[model samples]
Target: MAELRLEELTAQTIVAARNLALKPGQAAFIAPETYVHVEQDLDPAGSWPRVVMDGDHLVGYVMGAFDADATEDFLKAALWRVHVEADAQGAGVGRFAVQALADEARRRGFDRLTVVWASGEAGPEEFFKAVGFEVVGETPYGENLGALAL
Candidate 1:
């Protein structure tokens, strides 16, 4: 297995992160543009956006939140968005990235990590479940809400 790492998203990596592309049929799950827009809108105090790296190569991107003061309905440490590049999917990159996010949440004193994905999407529900998340509920927008107790 390759060593998977998460690097803090910085000005130097933003362009590469924004250029990551999802596989066919996967775009409905999340958009790269959303990651860029969210990164722009949320101050560093409210979000931690990271570039997923395999060795020195940028392979994906993920955004998470640790802000206990967040006014949004999501109170726990949540994985706001994650996307593995089209070429890197199914090589355990997604698994490693989620596990890394969970580890980060644990480091922040969080006991759980929450994520929401489009319920109607094909792959995400199974991918999340395979990584130890359980379907807990549905978001008001009908997304599948899941939790992993770290």
Candidate 2:
């Protein structure tokens, strides 16, 4: 495999990103009902989204949110979403994208980066755990809330 790289979502790549194919039963893991956002997060400055590329191929996409003024600690700096192509699942694309988000959080001076995920078969609990996010709590919607201290 070529070295994986991150790219800003561009007009040219957006279509490919939107078409990223996940393995069967994996789509539900990336977007749990408990994911939260406020009007303030609408600012482009607060949302950090990147597309993962292995040479010319769009292998994955990841997004994170940074809201210093958020009332909840977990919301302050959170990993919003990550979606990797089915074929790239075990090739480190997901981990690479997540670390990039954590790197951004560290750059912004956040002490931790949080994420929420639904638990079940084909879910990302194991992946998030392997990335060093601990289960800190549960959301009102019954999803697991995880945090990785930087």
Candidate 3:
């Protein structure tokens, strides 16, 4: 396994980031004005957005906030989007990213964090479960909303 480094994203990095993460059906959850804008200008002192970059490639990312608008302090968060290309899946990258998000949230005073995963996607539910996130709710697409206690 290569050393996976986590870093803050800037505006210049967003396009290449899309290459690593967004693949057709994977954009709805994380693609929007608010989410990308924040990542484009990461604020270490204010906002919580982090990316897992494998060398020069963006493998996965996690963003946390209190509300769906990503602006409250109730501290509810979404894994938003997490991907590692085809060859990288099941090679420990997703698990590592999830744990990284959990660690980040815990370090930031959040007691729990939520991840809304694609329901039809194979292996993700079990992966989240293996990471200690349990299904607490469901979405229209049968997507299981899982939560991990930080």
Candidate 4:
């Protein structure tokens, strides 16, 4: 394993973060339609976006949104997006990224962090659960709502 560190997503790293690869059948679980149903309504002010670096190489991206007043549970201190390169999957990149996000949430006075996933083969349901998020409920759109207590 290379040295893993989290960096604030900056202009210089934006392209690399956006280009992070995913395993086959993982595209359908990405934001704007599937797992992250809260993407369109996210407030930029509360967004905490970060990139995971493994010795100068971009390996993953994790985005969290913090909104204390969000009516939907998943929108508050939410796990907005997480994308890890296919080759790096299951090697702790995603877990490292999410732990950073959860730390940020704790700093912002949140007692928990929430995430939703589109359930199906190849979806990220197992990873989210393994990271300590329990299925709290289901979204109206049928996404699994998971909460990780901070």
Counting clashing residue pairs in each candidate, in order, gives 0, 0, 0, 0
Best by lDDT: 2
* TM per candidate: 0.83, 0.93, 0.68, 0.93
Ranking by TM-score: 2, 4, 1, 3
- lDDT score, candidate 2, position 16: 90
CA lDDT, every model vs. true structure: 0.76, 0.87, 0.62, 0.85
**Tens-digit lDDT track for model 2 on 1-150?**
799999998998889988899989987676777664343444467888899999999999998888898877777898988999998889899899999999999999999999988899999999999989999999888899999999
What TM-score does candidate 3 get on C-alpha atoms? 0.68
Model 2 spans with C-alpha error above 4 angstroms: 36-43
- Candidate 4: residue 52 lDDT (0-100): 91
lDDT of 3: 0.62
TM-score of candidate 4 against the unseen true structure: 0.93
Where in model 4 is the C-alpha error above 4 Å? Answer: 32-38
Q: Which run of 10 residues does model 3 get worst, by summed lDDT?
A: 66-75
Number of the predicted model whose TM-score against the real structure is largest: 2
The predicted structure with the larger TM-score, 1 or 4, is 4
Model 3: per-residue Cα lDDT over 1-150, one tens digit each: 678877777885565555664445544544433344344433334445667778876776655544433443222555655666655666777788778877876776767887666554443667778878888876545556678877
Clashing pairs in 1: none
